[model samples]
Target: MRPLVYEQTRFSPRVIFDAGNGVFEMEGTLMLEDNKVFFQTINRWWRIYQQSPNPQTKIVCKLNYYTLATDNFLMQWLYVLKDIPNVELIWYYNPDDWEMQEYATTYQSNYSFVKLKEEKVR
Candidate 1:
């Protein structure tokens, strides 16, 4: 499948799908004004992913510092990965953020891919 390229805006997060590499990477400041439009893009790709479920799918949540409003709504995206039947998810976080470890159970879905490492938050 030719990957889907969802452009990024000042308020919108960047989403890039790599069908060949088996990677679906999304990175940017999370502060979208329109929830419907923002979530629709995610939901559409998720539907595609559901149909063409890869053996391994890396969902990168590399956010520098999302606002509290964004954090609250972030659960919507997380729920998308909650119980992916066969796809392995990668929820990589900066080890420096103490908040990551505190909320371990929040990401029980394919937990193995959830790695806390020392990396620059793109």
Candidate 2:
């Protein structure tokens, strides 16, 4: 399957879903006004990816900030990954940000199937 890449916008994040490499990553901020349109496109692509997923899938989420709209979309996306057997999810955050850490913890608790790992960065 061909990779799906969405360039980052002022109000959105950069999304890279590489089926070939089994590396799926989303980085930067995500607070788009047109969140539904953007996230649905990703949902469609993920459905297709689910059909013939790579042996090991690594998903990295490195968001500087995100609005609730993005979190709404992410819950859906995480559920999709929650069902996948060979998925590893890593959420990176600044070590100094307690809010981000709490958010990650809450998300990880809610989605127990994801095996979420919180990575602290500088």
Candidate 3:
């Protein structure tokens, strides 16, 4: 499947979903007023990728901030990964950001495939 990439914008996050390399990552802030249009392509791509997924798929998420809509979409997105074998979902949060840490914890608890990591400073 072809990759889906989106550059970060003021109201959206940067997304890179490369099925060829099995690297799916999203970062930056997501505060869009409406996420349906933005996520539609991702949803479609994911559906196609699910048909013939890689042996191992790794999804990394590193966000500074995100809206409730984005949060909901994330949960839904993760749910789709549940049925895929050998899928790993990693959520990275800054060490000082308690809210992000808690959010990661929540996701980890809800999804067995989720793994949380404190972001390392460069």
- State the C-alpha lDDT per candidate: 0.62, 0.79, 0.83
Instruction: Write down the lDDT that model 3 would get.
Output: 0.83
Residue by residue across 1-122, what tens digits does model 2's lDDT show? Answer: 88889898777788899988776988888888887898888888888888888878878888878886577788888877776667777888776777777778777888764444455542
Using TM-score as the measure, the top candidate is: 3
Off by over 4 Å in 3: 120-122
Instruction: Tell me the alpha-carbon RMSD of every candidate.
Output: 3.2, 2.0, 1.7
Q: Please count the clashing residue pairs in each candidate, in the order shown.
A: 0, 0, 0
Model 3 lDDT-worst window of ten: 113-122
How far in Å is the alpha carbon of 93 misplaced in model 1? 3.5
Supply the TM-score for candidate 3. 0.91
After superposing candidate 1, which stretches have Cα over 4 Å from the reference? 95-105, 108-113
Where does candidate 2 stray beyond 4 Å?
113-122
Evaluated with lDDT, which candidate comes out highest? 3
Ranking by lDDT: 3, 2, 1
Candidate 3 per-residue lDDT over residues 1-122, each given as its tens digit? 78999998877788999988777998888888877777777777888888999999899888888876677887777777788788898888889988778878989999999998898511
